[model samples]
Target: MSTTTYAVLVLIGILFFVAMDLGKRDKGNDVITLISDDDDQEEHS
Candidate 1:
């Protein structure tokens, strides 16, 4: 494979792993509460 192809493949692999990691973390309710709290504060301000 060419150098450019190899670099692209490596970049894609890194992104795939990062996405998988974020999926595994899966902070569902906490994220919702945090967002809601921020919105409430913004509205109050």
Candidate 2:
């Protein structure tokens, strides 16, 4: 196949996968979870 044809095919494949990925639904905010510990321990006299 010609280089142009190959390029077009690759581009279409990439676009198709991207579309499918975007169409997918995520369950929720499962991408990342933040846990912070702001409490500090101090010694009392």
Candidate 3:
């Protein structure tokens, strides 16, 4: 296989492991959210 092929294979393996690790951490299937301050809302009023 060429260098590019090897690099792609390695990337795929890394992504697979990362996905599995993330899946294992799930509990009760809860959704995670990022809350931002409503600074713009205050300024517009």
User: What TM-score would each prediction reach against the true structure?
Assistant: 0.55, 0.52, 0.55
Please tell me which model should have the higher lDDT, number 2 or number 3: 3
Write the residue-wise lDDT of candidate 3 on 1-45 in tens digits. Answer: 699999999999999998877875773244322112355556677
Model 1: per-residue Cα lDDT over 1-45, one tens digit each: 699999999999999999977875787667778999999999999
Inter-residue clash pairs, candidate 2: none
Task: State how far residue 10 of model 2 sits from its true place (Å).
Answer: 0.1
**TM-score ranking from best to worst?**
1, 3, 2
* Model 1 clashing residue pairs (backbone): none
Per residue, candidate 2 scores C-alpha lDDT tens digits across 1-45 of 699999999999999988867655452233322111222222221
Give Cα-based local distance difference scores for all models.
0.89, 0.59, 0.69
True lDDT of residue 27, candidate 1: 74
Higher TM-score: candidate 1 or 2? 1
Model 3 stretches with alpha carbons more than 4 Å out: 27-45
Model 2 C-alpha lDDT versus the unseen true structure: 0.59
Name the runs in model 1 displaced over 4 angstroms: 27-45
lDDT preference between candidates 1 and 2, better one:
1
